[model samples]
Target: MLSMPLRLRPGDDLRGAIEAVLREHGAAFVLQGIGSLSVARLRFAGRPQPDVLAGDLEILTLAGSVSPDGAHLHMAVADAAGRVSGGHVAPGCIVRTTAELLVALLPGHVFAREHDSGTGYPELSIRPVPQASAS
Candidate 1:
């Protein structure tokens, strides 16, 4: 497992940025943990959940995982009010302020996405990625 530290800029969508990184790096498995900061435009499933969170609050925790293709992402975030909300992240969620993140990359595996009829969303299936041979 390889780990990298990330600092999210202001007005950026935390989840979106992570997904972008996964796509760029071709990460088969990604583990994002230990985030603290503020963000806005929070949503759960398909609906907005801002009412459940206080205004411009500090993110006590922000954690999630992503696939190489960025098909599935699960995340949870807490505010200064101590209220936590999370789910299958939706699009358009933006950062109110800033966030710090730790991203782990797995190179030996490849993540493939397929739609699950039961869950109604794309799910990841792990596959082995062949190592590069010395030229």
Candidate 2:
């Protein structure tokens, strides 16, 4: 397991920036943990409305995984109000305060994105990689 501390600057899209980090790192192998992100957008499944979060909202919880290409990410975020929301992250979520993230890289694991016949959204697929492989 690896821990990463990330601070999103003002005007930075919370989810997009996270995915960018994964891309910069190549393949994570595994996303073991994340915590404390301020002013994030939480999109709920089955609901068209997305919550634009900001200000003193303690990150109640966060859960998600990154795609093998590192360009896509799926996550759930709950704010201080105890309301939980998540979905296919879009842009425009600015970091009002700061975001600190913890990520784990699994050297032997690989996560990729493929279109699902049912959902139509790119879904994550996991596979094992040779120890020396990079993607």
Candidate 3:
């Protein structure tokens, strides 16, 4: 695993930015993230639509896995009044100040999303990288 740091500026879409990193690294996991956001789009448990929180929000926690197919991230944030809310991180999480993350890249494996009949949603599929012969 290769660990690297990522920083995002204002107006960056949190999920998209992380997905871009995943695309570059092939497979990676976000160990953690901290930052401020002007807007937060989060989908609560069992909700089809995401709630948009717009204001000075502080990211309390962020962690997830990122594959070339997509990202599955969970995040918690605190509002100006100290109200905390957490849910699945969605797109349009625009940065207010900055977003700093530590990502671990997997070099010997690949991650893909495959539809699972049991869950009725696309799920992560992990596979090992094929070793090449030196002959």
Per lDDT, the best of the predicted structures is 3
Candidate 2 runs further than 4 Å off: 29-40, 48-57, 68-88, 131-135
- TM-score-based ranking: 3, 1, 2
* Residue-level lDDT tens digits of model 1 in 26-82: 553334544443444455665635323435555545555567567454556666666
Off by over 4 Å in 1: 28-54, 132-135
Give the CA lDDT, 0 to 100, for residue 51 in model 1: 29
Which digits, one per residue and each the tens of the lDDT, describe model 2 over residues 5-83?
A: 5566656676677777776543453243344555656566676766666654444344467654644544556667777
The clash count for each model shown is 2, 2, 0
Worst 10 residues of 2 by lDDT: 25-34
Residue 102 of model 2: what lDDT?
65
User: Which residue pairs come into collision in candidate 1?
Assistant: 37-59, 39-96
**lDDT (Cα) of model 3:** 0.94
- In terms of TM-score, the best-performing candidate is 3
Writing each residue's lDDT as its tens digit, candidate 3 over 44-69 gives: 99999999999999999999998899
Global lDDT of each candidate: 0.61, 0.60, 0.94
Q: Model 2's lDDT to the true fold?
A: 0.60
